[model samples]
Structures are given as structure tokens and as C-alpha cells.
Target: MVLLPFSARNTSETNDWNGSKLKDDSKHYKLLVVGGGAGGLGAASKFARKLPRGSVGIIEPHEDHYYQPGFTLVGGGLMTLRETTRKQEKLIPSGAKWIRNEVVLFTPTQNMVTLDGGEDISYDYMVVAMGAHLRFDKIKGALEALETPGVCSNYSPFHVEKHYREVMNFQGGNAIYTYPNGPIKCAGAPQKACYITDSILRQRGVRENAHMIYATSLDKIFGVENYVKPLEEVAQEKDIDVRTRRNLIEIDTSKNSATFQLLDENGAATEDTEKIEYSLLHIGPPCSAPKALRKSPFADKTGFMDVDDGTLQSKKFPNVFGVGDCMNTPNAKTAASVSSHLKTLDRNLTFAMLGKKPYFKYDGYASCPLVVSKNRVILAEFNSKGPLETTPLNQGKPAYWAFLLKKYFMPALYWNGLIRGYWNGPATIRKFSRLVDSKKRQGVL
Candidate 1:
């Protein structure tokens, strides 16, 4: 593999090996991956190791890679912001060609993608992994409100550290946290910050004075009912007020007031508006797929890459596939979900390349380690059907052991196993544990 010298030409211009202009026609690759996030990197790593050298080309704009799940811990002070990031060059597989560019257009019809620089890259097969976009500016008063002392959010790398500072500075008052009205990565994260803040306040002997409140646009605490009951119990035990059907509308930083529109059970906005004074605010903003992909012909009506739920291939374009947060798969967006996606995508894409049908189907497995407190967690593992537990022990119950797995083992598995294309989540482990549990019951009889 050779490292091409950095050409200073504009993105639209064609270049030769000697830095001069090339002929109209250009080179292509077997696989082209857009985005360098978890899904893109995961797919690139698998293809680079399995396919011949120079077979894969990755178009990613960022020079750094982030382990985004750790951002919650960073906000909780369990990990530093520095720990969540690494150089993108280190993560991109050695054999793959890296184009430090963003995809400006997706031309599925032509089997090509145009980069921001105006250069066109053609591929025999393409994988779209450009993850979701966080739009904080869409919310009214969000930008102005966030500049105030009490306002903070953990959604972006730029704003994550402010969460801890805001929580710590809170003397005593309504400490509100929120979940936006759309699909968000790590659904448990908004509440995780609240839980961590509650624990922190208790440690500082201020828990009694602080009124912890959670305002979410969703009607339920969690999507899965199995975890919802136990999580509600945890909130009750912590004296946190959980309000559903409340959407954050505006913020008045000068007056230190947060405004919310109350919605009925049917999701219609009611006439009444609620205002609360807050000492601290943690926000989870709305997210969507990158604009380029969302507007492209490849996207579904919901603005995500329309892929087969089972095989991870585009429903309209067989040669195009997606993995990670960008795909319209019915799984919670988490690193755990990405682990499962990569496994199914690897096998199915390989089969597709061989002109054969995909044998394996993804079950929508996604896991969220609900950090209920500083030392305990409830490992919520589920698939499209419902919760899929791996441990023989009951998972709905909070356990210290589960916390340890989340804090230590899970990070290692993500960096080494998932990123290396070796991990496929805990599905096999879940199956094996079920078998062991069955045998144990028989023996007890």
C-alpha cells in the first residue's frame, strides 16, 4: 500500500500520479465506504482484511475518531473527554485508501459518490455509514439559552464537558433533563446524566435540596416495557419527577425560566404551557441522517437509508448497503447495535458479492447499560421482538456486576472486537446462556 502525497488541487479537478491533470476517465474500487464513524469503520475494517489490497476506499471528512458512547461517562466525570477520541488515521484499516473528504452527493444510479471537493469516486459496491446529524439549532431559543449559566447538553463533543460543570455548580433548585421527540442515539443517555447528577448531589450532601426532574417528549420512560417498570422504580426511589408528553419549546436565560408545551396522550399540543425555574438543564437534541443521504434517491421516506431489515442491503439498490445509525433498521442506536449490524452486514455483503443470497438475518439486537447510580446498572439488551438477555441472572434488576461490565469490558470489546470486525454482540452468548439455564432447571427437578 502507498500513501499518496497530499494534492492541493480543488475538489473538482482531476489529478495524475505526478500531480498533473489526468485523462477524463479515472480509477475505481471494488467497495467505497462513506463516513468514518463506527459503521463506516466497521465495514471498512472487515472489507480491508477480507478483500485484496487497494480494494476499498473510504471517504470520511473527520481526521479524528470518537467512541461516542463514552461521552456520557465523560459528562458524568467517570472518563475524561480526551479518552473518547483517537486519530482517524489510526482506526482506518491499513490496506484501505482514505480520502479525507465528505460525500456531497450520492449517485446510486451511476454507482458513484461525489465528494465535497467535486471529485467523483466510482465503486462496484457502496456502503453508506454517514451517521445521523444533531440539530440543536432547530430548537427555538436553544442557542441563546445554552449560552447561559444553567443550560448544558451532552449531545455533542463540543458541549459535553459543560454538563459536569453545570451540574456541579447547581446549589439547589429544579434540575431538569430532557429527551427530544425523535430517534436518538443511546436512548438511555439523557437519563443517565440525570442519574449521575442525582448521585453526585447525594455525595455532595445536596440531594435533599435539589429537585431532579425529567421532561421527555415520549409517553414512556423507555421503549421496552420490561425495562420501563424497573427504571420507573429507580426514578421513584431517587425522588426524580418523570414527566412524559412534555416537549421543551423555549428558554428564557435572562429570567432563568424553561418553557414546555404539554401534549396529550395522542401527542397533540394542549393549550396550557408550563414554565419552570431551573438551576441546571441537560438536553438531548433531535437527530437525523446527514442531509446528502437524506435528500438522495436512496433514502426512504423517513430520511434514512432504506435497507432490508434482515440483510442490511438497500431495498431499492442492491449494490448499496448501510450500517450503524444511518440505516433505517428498527434497532436502538448504540455501539452495541452497531456490533450486531456489522456481523450481519459482513456476511450478507460477502454473499452478495458472490452473487448469492444472504443466509443470516439481523434480529435488531441493541443493548443499553443503564447506569442507575455510580456503582450499579441495569443491562437492557433487546432485539426487534423484545428483550434478549445474555446472563442467566435476571437482567431487569440493577446489578453492580453489570456496571463493571459496562465501565470496563464493553469499551475493550468495542475498540478491539467490534472495530476489528470480530465482535457480533452477545447473541451467541445469549443463546449459550439460555441452554445452560435450561439444563440447570432440569437438574434441579
Candidate 2:
């Protein structure tokens, strides 16, 4: 059961939030949530129940909400695009008002935000969960390449379905997958696609003719050292050419070719460039914080929302906070991390509402289900300090049960548990499992 703050019941609202239609352009709310993605929905649902009706307002322009983690499954032929999507209206919390518009400008100092439709809304407290924006056009000719026959991407909804189809129809040649130069939401997704493709090709007896390559701008395959060895082993076993320090810069759809800028160990581009022709290509497009947030007063030097990593509160604005990919936290930008953020942000923001400083702190917990094949996965969980496994089993090693957890269980948990704000990640389960393991070791069970 969710704990509600008894002191924050009498919240100010523009109109009766329970009404079906929005009244005016100018509005006010006790709490304003920006972006309707995982983080936004989680925060809104949690606080909507805590505050009075018409007190919480969620500003989101899109008509659909996507289960972003399901994209890899869709690309791997395990799920459909429709299964990953839901109408945005159906997900909004019952008591909260939904403002169907984009935020064009943020005036956090004045506790107000300007919408693209020329309306201004004010709030006493705000949560920035705008998330990340995919920039496929950053690569020259990328847009055109996406339209080409053999090139595809799992990042975009428009091209995600094409990925499995391309893999299915693959006759053989160079099948190249790329990871961009900077931080992406799911850092492991690019290689997930590569591994899935390798599995498919081998199953279809086309592995002999296919030259699989995993090109990445990072110096290593994965950031966490604990999971790197297993991933490297997987690549080696599949005979994949793992190329590091190579950032894709251009794509020529007509020529069926791609150009990459070679980088030094420091990740700075060198003078050298390489071009490779491909029979199939999967691009992991570069991503960053949304435009408004990037240019807002809350952003850090890296164009991501600047927040206190521990408290999830804005360093510049005390009344503001951030969650998800938009925040400049060291943790991997996955939905799992967002779920972890919800609890921390909730405790801290609720304290703020009561005119008190934040007491709860977030330990940078994150998890990435590295899908190595249709039947195997390496569940990589970690924090700022190092590897922090949840289960009693060794998560560093790929396991079939982990794959089943990722493929079958996670989506249901996300839709029914996390989105509705009940899920707070696997911390509770981890604690319980650890207790059981300790009892077993002492012969207590």
C-alpha cells in the first residue's frame, strides 16, 4: 500500500481536476509533471493519490505511451510493436489533469512553464521527466538510409518492426550493428540486437556467409567490468568482429555503405576514417535530453537536467526535481533505474511539500538485461560503487531463466506494477532472497 502525506491534502488546482474537459490555457497546480514516459507516469500516479483532486497536472503531447524496453524484444522477433504501446489517455491517473501540449519554455524560477500552444501553467512543485530524444539525423544521410531496404534501427517505432524482418530475410554478407558515441537510454541494446541477429542467422544456417560486426564508440563492450567478460565470450563464441572506438558518421543508402570516424582511446575522433559496405545495417541513433530541458536553467554542462544525484532534487531550484534519462546521473539510463528513482523522488518531494529538507537518498541502482540470444540473458545490476546483484544466483553469467524473466515477466510487471506506481524495483525481493540464502547457509530453513 502507498503511504500518503497527511499534511499535503489541501492542494490548489485550476478547476475540478475530475472534469473531463480542460477549461482554459492558463492553469495552476500544486504539482506539475513534465513528460509522460515511464518516469513521468510513475511520479504522477504516486503523487496524484497523495494530493487532493485537481492538484496534480501532467503535461505530455504524445497520444501514445511506449514500453521502451520492449523495443529490443520487438527487434528480436519475440514481441510485436502494438504490444509495446498504449494510448496516453488511458494511463493518466484519475485525479490528475492531463495537459495535451508540449513545454516550449521552462521558467522554474517563477514556478511556471510555457506550452507550445501559447499557454502558461504554474505549479508550486515540478518534476522534470522529459526523458531523452533520439537524433538519427545527426548522422549524415541517416534519414534516407532508414528508408532504404537493408538498413534499419530498433530505436525508432517507424523502423523497429523492420529490424526482425531484415534479419529474417537476410541472405548474407556484412551484417553491421552500431552503438553511438554518447550515452543512450539502454546502453546494451545495440549489442543485444547484434547477438539476437547472430542467433537468428546461425539458426537459419546463414552464419557461414554472414560477417557479423559490433561497432561501438566506447573503448569496451560494456561499462560494468563484471559483465564484460561474459559478453566478450559471447561475441568470441559467435565469431563477431567487435570493433571499438568507431563512431558511425555517415550512411549512403544508394551505395549500401557507411562511413565511421575512428577515435583514439580517449574517445576523441582521430584523423582516420573507414567505410564498410553492408548487406544489412542496424543503427543505434544518438540520444540526448529533450530540447527545452537541455536549454533550461536546470541543465548541466552535458545538456542533461542537473539534479542532486542522491536526493534527485534540482541543484539550482529547490522546488524542482528530475528523474529518468533527462537527469545527469551516472547510473545506466534504463527503466529499472527510473523505477528506483520513483521511491527516492517520492520521499524527497513529499518532504519538500511539507516544507522540510529531503531525508531519503538514492543509491545509484540500475539493471540491464543483456539479451545475448532468444533463450539466454546476462542480468547486469550495479550501482555507483560497483556490481550489486539482486538474486542469489550469479547474475554475471547468462541464464535461460533470466531470459524468461526478461521476455515474459518484465513487461507485465512494467505495465501493471511500475506504470501504476506500485513497483519500486527489485530491492524488496533482493532483501528477501538474501535473507533466505543466509538462512539456508546456516541450516535454518
In terms of lDDT, which candidate is strongest? 2
Query: How far in Å is the alpha carbon of 410 misplaced in model 1?
Result: 0.9
Q: In candidate 1, list every pair of residues with a backbone clash.
A: 11-117
Residue 371, candidate 2: how far off, in angstroms? 0.8
What's the lDDT for all of these models?
0.83, 0.90
Error of 2 at 48 (Å): 0.6
Tens digits of lDDT, candidate 1, 309-402: 8899898888778999998999998889998898888888777766678768988999999999888899999887798888999889989999
Candidate 1 has an lDDT of 0.83
Count of backbone collisions within predicted model 2: 0
- For model 2, how does the per-residue alpha-carbon lDDT over 319-351 read when each residue is reduced to its tens digit? 899989999989999999998899899889988
Q: Output the TM-score of candidate 1.
A: 0.92
Question: Least accurate stretch of 10 residues (summed lDDT) in model 1?
Answer: 1-10
